[model samples]
Each structure stands twice: as C-alpha cells, then as structure tokens.
Target chain A: MQYLSVVDVARHFGRRKALSQISFSCAAGEMIGLLGPNGAGKSTLLNILATLIAPSKGEVKYGDQGANDGADVRAQIGMLGHDLFLYPELTARENLEFFAHLYGVTDVHSTATRALHTAGLVDRGDDFVAGFSRGMRQRVALERALLHEPKLILLDEPFTGLDQTSTAALVGRLRERQRAGCLIVLATHDLDVADGVLSRAIYLKDGRMVGSDTGSSNLADRYRRAMDRGPRNADSALWGGE
Target chain B: MMRAFFRVAWQVMRKDMTVEIRSREILLTTLLFAVSVVLIFSFALVREGRAPDDVAAGILWVAISFSGTLAMGRTFERERYNDTLRALILAPADRPAIYVGKLLGLLLLMLLVEIVLVPMVGLLFAAPIFAYPGMLLMLLVSGTLGFAAVGTLFAAMLVRVRSRDTLLPVLLYPITVPVMIGGVRGTAALFQAVPDEPMARFWIGLLLFWDAIFVTLALWTFEPVMTE
Candidate 1:
C-alpha cells in the first residue's frame, strides 16, 4: 500500500524550466526508470524526489506524507547522485559508518561491515576512497546509500562509467534490492542494462513527460521512439507503478 | 528530542575534527598564516623595539579575522569538493543541529590557533603577558563564537557558489565588524600597561550579546538557506 505520488510536479530555475507538469506514481516493490537524453530534466526530477529541491509547482506525496512532514520522511529515503557523496579523505568503512550513523542505523559498526561486504570491498575497507577507481567508488557509494535499508531509493545515473563486469555486478545488486520490495527511481542512460529490469519506463524530453508505460522491452528502441514523438501525441499514463 | 539533536551535532563535529587530524590541511595553513601575520605586523609597526599604542591589539585581531576567514573557507570546501553537503542535507538530522555541529567544529579550530596567536602577539609586541588570563580566555571564546557563528552560516551559504574564495572575505569581513571591534577593544584593554578591567568586561559582555544574536539567527535561517 506504500507508494510515492507526484501530482503535477514542476521545477523551474530562473527563466529556465527544468521540469514541467511531470506526474507519475510508483508503489513499493516497483522499479521505475526515468529514461531520456541529455538535458531531459532526469536529474532534476530525481533531485525533486530526493527532497533536495522543491518544485516550483505541484506536490510530491510519499505514502500520504510529504517532504515537509519532516526528518522522519527523509529518513526513509536514500539517494545517490553525480557526486557520489563520499569523502575522499575517509576510508571506505569510515564513509559507510558515517552515513550509517547519520541515518540512525543501529549497530553502526556491523552495518558498515555488512555494507562493505555487499560492495565486495571487504578487503579494501580500510583504504581511503581518494585512491579508489571509478567503479570501486561507485560500488561503495551504492552500498552507502543502501546502508539504512531505505524504503525509497533515488539514484541519478547509477551506472555512468563502468566496465562490463562491474556493470553486471551493479545490475545484479539492484535486482536484489528490487526483490526486497524497495521502491527505486533511477535516471539512467544505460538503456541496455535497464531494458527489462525496470517495471516501467518514464521517458522525458525538455522538461516534459513524453512517454510512460509498463514497457518491459528493448529500452533503447523505446526511448528513441518516445523521443521522436511530440508531447501532445505521447502517452502520459499515470499509474501506481504496480 | 534534545538528546538526539546534540548527538547528531557531536557526530558532525567529531567527523570534521577527525578529518582535520588526519589531513592537517586547514590547521597547518591557518596556523602558519596567523603567525606570519603577527610577525609581519610586529616588524612593520614596531620601532626601536616599541610597538605603537594599541597596535598590538589591532594587529592580533586583524590576524585572527584574516586567518579565521581562511579557516572557515576550508570548513565547507571539503564538503563542496565531493558534494558531501548534498549527503548531509539529505540526512534525517535536524538542519539546525547540523549548523550547530559545524559551528562547534569551527570554534575549536579557531581556539587552537588563538592559543599560539595570543602568546606570540604578547611576546613580539611587548604586550602584558600575564595581566589577566581568565579575561583573555573569555574574550577569545566569546569573540570566536560570535565571529564563527556568522562565518559558518556564510560559508555554508557559499558552498555551491562560484568565486567563493574571493567572495567569503568580502562577505565575512563587513558582517563581522562588531565582533572584530569587541575582540580588538577587549584585548587592547587587557594588553594595555594599566589593565582596564572594567573596559575589557564591557566588550566581553557586548561580544557575548552578539554571540547570542548571531547564533540564534544562524540556527533559525540555516535550514532555509541550505534547502535551495
């Protein structure tokens, strides 16, 4: 019954429209993909979902609770964005433990250790993230975001730069989370990896929702087709991401 | 609720201190810069081994404020570097608690630098060394608290801004005038050949008042300013 609903959400930045009339809803146990090309406002939508920014218009409801419902609402949401949010000066374990503590996770030491194991960085847990390769840091950051077992996870470009092996590992982990019944909303250009894993795809272009459906097919082709169409002709189906 | 707020604040402060302990980037740069400021003024203002009247106190505060800006600049730079501020903003902790934690961390760093700075100014400028230790400590703490209360807020506000390095001082120095006046005047009264106990006490009282106002304002506005 838990769900996230966006009602006519729009965000603008000083004469520039980042997102406009965007509307969708995703229920728990669903994984929705925000697919688009550059400047598609995918990151903006993700930021709005994470409560990092407010929409200039409309409202976002998290199971009848909004972001203004206070810190408790934020506690149930986790995010991973372009920055990775990990301190390079801190060791991998330290980074995880720090976030675990902030998230009010009990038994922080063990939680961080478990996260290290999940990231497959148990051997390199003590090493500073400054020296980590892109894929390695990405994995650690992903675990950091998941440490609190958040009910909702917002990720922007979760798989930006990765090798085939790392990409496969990340996809597998995401699928595992999907099975755990955590609602996930990710902005990704890695359509090939996201193809069938997503329960639905919401295609956006120039700050508007262009297409959306329970399209469990070749995402790249679907994305191309969606982008080629006009907004008036595109499908704007609003579902609970069931 | 109070316990949770304080705990999160302590965690944030401890994390900053840990990073400083490991890196020493801010501390070393700030300490060396403060000492250099003191020494340069001692040479420029002192003549025949005698510093001009009230110059030592002015020199000390100028050093503190200039070096404090440098220190405060680095406080959020680390967060801005990796966009850790985004992570922090997304945390479930009360926004004001996070501000308090950052202020606490900055206060400790400023006090550490002042420990070396005060004595160095005394020795170089021939100011009274042991006139009143308690009064000097109170002035330092109150002045630092007031100054850093404003600095922390501005630093947080400027984290995502461009040309922030050039902007921090421009924004910081003008806003912290009352704090600087209270600090310099209070310390001068203490350093004078005839220690003006009542005069130093007045400035200390004034600085404490400013501390209350700045801290309250910063805590109140922190959440809104940071929300973006």
Candidate 2:
C-alpha cells in the first residue's frame, strides 16, 4: 500500500516563517484532519505537499520517493485549494474534460461524465460556472480535483461556504473515497466537522505542530487543549504528550 | 514523452478555442481594438496630407501590437478570475506544454484579427500588400510568433500582479522591440512605392532569429516563473 511521509518540512516567505520543522506520516486508508487557527500554515503545508510550492527545508515523500520537482510525484496528489481553479466561462463538463486531458486520462469524455455524476452536477454540467452559486461552484471544483482519480487528496477548507445539504453530500462522497483506500488530508477550522469525519487530527499553530490526536477520540477538545497550551514553553510537553 | 507534451498543449489550445468561440469576448475586443487603431491612423495620416501607403507598415504593425496586447490581457484575465492558471500548472504534464499551449491560442486569435486587418489596410491605404501575398504572410507569421512568444511569457508572469493590465505592455514592448522593428521594416519593404526585396529579406531573417531565441527562452523560463 502507498503512504506519505513528510519530514521536518519548513517554508519561509522572505523573513517570515510560514511553516517550520513540521513532520508527520500517514498511510493509505487513513483520514487525517489538519486543524489550525488562522495563519497557522494549513494552506502552506498543503501547498508544499501538493508540490505547488517547494519547501524551504526538509522533504515530502510518497512511498520511498521524494516529492522532487517532477510531474511523476505530483501526478498522484489531488488538491482543492482556497482557489477553486475552475474556469467560470467554461461549463462544468468542459472544465472537467480539459483537466482530464491534462492529467492524461485515457478517455476524457467518459471520465469527465463520471466525475460530473460523482459531484452531483450531471444535470448542471452544461451550465457556465459563472452563473453557479457558491455551493455549485464548490461541487464543480470537487469534481475537477477528483476528475483524474488521484490517490492522495488534499482539501483546504473544503467545507467553507457549503450549505448543510451540500456539505452532507460532499462529506458522503469523501467518506466513500476514503473507504476505497485513498489517503486523505483535510484542513479545516471547523472542529465539529473534523471530529465527525477524521480518524486522527494534527494540530498546528504559529508554524509548528502543537500536537496530534491518534486515539480517535475527543478531537475538538484535544485540539483546543493543544492550541491553548501555546508554543512558547510547551513544545517539549506537546512532543511528550503526542 | 514528447507526444504527451504536444498532446497536452493541443488540449489546452483546444479548450481555449472552445471558450473563445462561446464567449466571443477576446475575439470581438481584439478586432474592435485593431480596427479602431487602423481607422484612427488613417484619419491622422490623411490629415497630415501623407499617402497612407508611405507609412502603411508602421500603421499595420502598431495596430497589431496594440491589439495583440489587448488579446493577451483578456486571455489571462479570465484565467485570473477563476484561478485556472493554478489548474494548468497542477496538471501532470510537462511545464513547457502549458506555455506552448497558451502561445498557440494567442497566435490563433491574433491571426484571426490580422486576416481582417490585412485586407482592410490594403484596400484603405492602397499599400499593395496583396501584390506579394506569400512574402507578406511570411513576414506576418514570423513577427507575430516572435511577439506572442515574449508577450505570452510576460502575461503569465504578471497574472497576479496588481496592475497587470498596464504592466504587461510596459514590460512587453521594451523586450519585443527587435520583433516590432523587424516586422515594421519587413512590411515597409513590401509596402514601398518601389519594394525593396533585399531589405525585406534581411528583416525577415532577423524576425525569424528573434522568434527562435524568445520561444526557446519562454519554454525554459515558464516553469520556474509560473510555479513560484
């Protein structure tokens, strides 16, 4: 089975440290929740893992291979970032078809059609994304990320702006995919959602890993404890607690 | 691997074509800008009591340059609004394929406008460009390719910059002087009351050289600039 290992990863934006000395490892069939406050480097970590931006230090590896500056490793990772990355002018089907070709999908049309169905956008496939409501656009973006059927999925704040029905629908799809042995990482501030969906939760604050909950219990409470402990003098305690 | 790269590039171009066909936004705006520039030049030159043909090459290229910039700007503006550039970069394909794909799309749109602009210039200014159709075409392709090569790179680079629309021409025009000069001189030789075959050949050679150098650079630099 495939697995991901990120060791001592650090990223700096000029003099500002965005992420520092972050390390974690997870195998396929596990859903990890990346929980953090604002500016806690959730997006930066996902970006590094997605290979959108290189880490300033350390490494990200899949199986035994490093996330080198090549398309081979990136081919296995799917990311839905803060930006939806969908063309508003293109219909949802067209957007999926275009991305399918880029990912070298064997049959662009059939694959795109399947993805549209998965996102529950089959009826709305031909409508321009420009007119889509926020929930609909999010669904299209989700389909676009899944269009290539990547092995590792990283979603940053995927639940944002989603209504109850849309959120439930998306969560069900994610659960289905996770059960299929795909490794998933979700970054969100919603502790309730994180508690409900994730098997483990990794907490980050001020560019450092505060703690991680591995026992699959009290994730929101543990997350609050981790965040409240703060990083000034609690680093050692946090490590020992983990 | 090369086949895959070209295939990705073709898909990107095809997607752009489909979008442009449906929206008609880039095509109409570029055409309107090109025609407006030509008409405005015609009136200005007529007021100066100058035969439009005497300066036909300059007018034609200026119109092409301005309109091409407009087209390139709109092309990325759409990408910016939807953050689709990130999607393009995230694709599991060769990085250069994306640049080549966008360059091809821009070239096609620019050519579509030139198809109309060329005949109008000949009819309105009596430049006799139709007298040397093959030579005129050679000059146009080389020059436009060179311009597109550099313009496409800068446009992608400036996609996230605050003042990208204005910054593109400011950055692009300076770097592309060689292409612009070569194009204007080549067209001038063709438009002269007594055409200069040797002069046109020299400028065409320069234009081709300019294109070769810039396209190679764009292919090499696109990955780094865009990813960062």
Candidate 3:
C-alpha cells in the first residue's frame, strides 16, 4: 500500500477500448483525483485500481503486489463505486456489523457502534437503511467502506448525494484520512469541492490520460485549460504523472 | 484458514436467516407456490376412490424444483436489488465461503418447503412416507444439497443479467438432472406398494456422490463466474 503503480494499463471491452496506455503512480498521504468529462473512463480506471476488474494490457501494482498476488492484499484496499452497496432492508448497525465480520474487524458490537457514531446516525442505527435520506445513506456507506481501515480508498463521486454540510464533512473526513497517510483516489465531477483537498488531479479524455493539474488555486480554470489545451494526437494521451 | 472460512460462512448464513425470519418473503412465497403445485396434482390426478400409483414421487420433485427455483431467484434478487452481492464479493473473506453460505441458506429454505409438501403428497397420493422415513430423509437431504449446490451458483451468475427471472430454471434444471433423477427414483422406491430399500439406498448414494461433485465444482467456479 505504500505505492500504487499503474503501468501502461489498458482495458478493452471486446472491441471497444475503455482505457489505453494509462500510467500513473502515487504514494501514501496523497489524494489524487481522476477528473474528466463523462465516459472518459474515470470509473473504469477506478475499477481497475480497485481490482474489481482487470486491465487488458498492464499491471496495477499495489506496492510490490497486484491482484494476482491473491486477496490478502485486498485487506489494504477499500472502495465506494457507483453503487452504494448497502441492503435497504437491514438496519444501519446490522449492515455495518455484517461487513465488519466479513472484514474480520475485532469487537464487532463496539466497532459497529463506532461506525454508526461516525456516520452521525447512532440514534438511527436501529432504523432500516431504506428509510434513510440519500445523504444519510452516503455517510453510512462511507463508514462501511472504511470499517477495515484500509490504506488505499477508492471513491467514485463521493459527493453526489450530499448537501453542502455533508459535503464539507466528507471533505473533512478525506482530509483526516489523508493526514493519517492513507492514499485516496477519487473520480468526481465536483471540481469546487475537490479543489482544496486534491494534491494532484489527473485528466482523462477519450480513454487516455490527457494531462494533470497540480496548482493550488483556480482549479476550475486549470481543469478547463487542461481539458482544452492538451494535445489531441494519438500519441499525446501518454502522460507521466507524479 | 478452515476456521476463518467456516466462520465467514456462518456469519453470512446467519445474516440471510435473520433477514428471512423478519421478512419471510422467500419462505412464504416458496411455501405457497409448492403447496399450490401439490394441490393442483391432488385435484387433477387423484380419482374418485383411488390415487394414481407412484404419482407421489413425480409430484414431489416437480413441486420442489419449481418452487426451489422461485426461492433461489428471489433470494439473489434481493442481493442484486441493492448491489449487495458486489459488497459481499469485495470483502476480504474467501469468495467460496460466500457461495457456501448462500447455498446453505437456499438449502434451508427448500427443506422447510419440503417439510410441508412431502406429507401433503403422502396423504393425497396414499404413499407410505412414514414407513421408510429414515431412507426418505437421506434421499431428501442428498437430493436437495446437490440441487442447491448447482442452483445457487447459477442463480448468483444470473443476478446481474437483465432476464434473470426467466433464466434461472433454464440453467438450473439441465445441470441438476442427476439430482432430480436420484430424488424422484429414490423417493419412488420407498413410496411404492412394496418398499424397495436397496433401490432407495443406491439412489441415495448416487445422490450424495453428485452432491460432492456439484458442491466442489460450484465452489471452484463461483469466484470466476461471479467476477466481472
């Protein structure tokens, strides 16, 4: 989990190429954002990194190991994809407890209580997830993904259903994780929300890594410039990300 | 490693059971569907003064197979509805353990349905169910295990498919032919006018062999089949 090296990674669905020759590497404490227009393969790249799907042509090395290294390495990884991955019928506490057991977390009862408390849903812990609001569910889902305290956390549109306050809370949580030396890779369209938290933003366009923006201020402007000014030739998608 | 594997399986089974107990969605639906199938046969085949000879075995297996398919579809449908299967797959626990847990849960549901359907078939068709209860129980357990082993795998594979409801039985029945044959033949031998204990015992052995093979194959393939 010290280094995530995606080397010449490509994913093709039958004849259609979802990603090609994309390479990037990041270390602990770095929060990298995958930024692009829709269908730019942001989610595809995240799936590849999460080991949920295999890349067609390259390797995503989680430190010195990869998906072929067996699932013991997965204990260091956590993911929140497009699906919330929660059962609506189960209470929030039940959901957390079930997952905690799967992840082999100790002190199941107290661990679930702590997760519910972190989600700010301790009072509603006994309530079914079906009855919870979208933001509430999102918060609980995030806590569920983090239950095992994974070093590598992949999030896709983590702010989608959040209000302004929840968004701030999420950003704060990400900051805390970042400060704790966990690597966070996220694909999000909310540039303003991500502007301050991301150390580097990787731009992808048409299944290739087009450019990156590492500047601190005016993220929206930088993103526009990166999207518009990048070379459009076949070979120009090649990028050496820090 | 064995302890961890079984521990995860037990937790998964417990979770499914808890949900089932509270909702009873799969259990109630499966029980009613099975009873309806048996009742249809009772009305259609049972004559004024006599029941069709050996119709009991066919009726029992048919009801179990049809209702078991329904229960499997509903059970996995609940998982795919919220994409919970993906969550379960993402866990660090052994993937085969998840498969076993689901199979165990489905087997339990089908067994509960069989508990009612078996006696109903006996009373209506005048089959001597209690005469060979021990042999009959072995046939049911082995037959159900083999069926569930294959059915659970296919049901899980179809969860993300658009036409999963129409597809489960289509895939399950063909692969579980051995199980159905053993169950029907074995149960028939016992319920006949002169119970053939040896025949029933042979079929039970064959059913158990099929169970081991189906479960091993299912466990080996569950991870790959489930993967995207």
Tens digit of lDDT per residue, candidate 1, span B1-228?
Answer: 898789889988988998999999999999999999999988788899888887888988888898999999999999998889989889988989889989999999989999899989998898885789999999989999999999999999999889889999899889889999999999999988899999999999999999999999999999989877
Listed in order, each prediction's TM-score against the native is 0.96, 0.93, 0.95
Q: Candidate 1, which segments miss by more than 4 Å at Cα?
A: A231-242
Cα RMSD to native, each candidate? 3.8, 3.5, 3.1
Error of 1 at B151 (Å): 0.7
**Candidate 1 lDDT, A54-127, residue by residue in tens:** 88999999998997876988898989888899999889999998888788888999999999998999999999
What lDDT would each prediction earn against the true structure? Answer: 0.89, 0.87, 0.89
* lDDT per residue (tens digit) for residues A39-102 in model 3: 7889999888877777889998888888876567678888886679888888999999999999
Q: Candidate 2 docking: what grade?
A: medium
TM-score (0 to 1) for chain B of model 3: 0.99
Q: By summed lDDT, which 10 consecutive residues of candidate 2 chain B come out lowest?
A: B45-54
Clashing pairs in 1: none
Clashes of each: 0, 0, 0
The residue-by-residue lDDT of candidate 2 on B132-182, one tens digit each, is 788899999999999999999999999989999889999999999999999
Pairing residues by index, what is the TM-score of model 2? 0.93
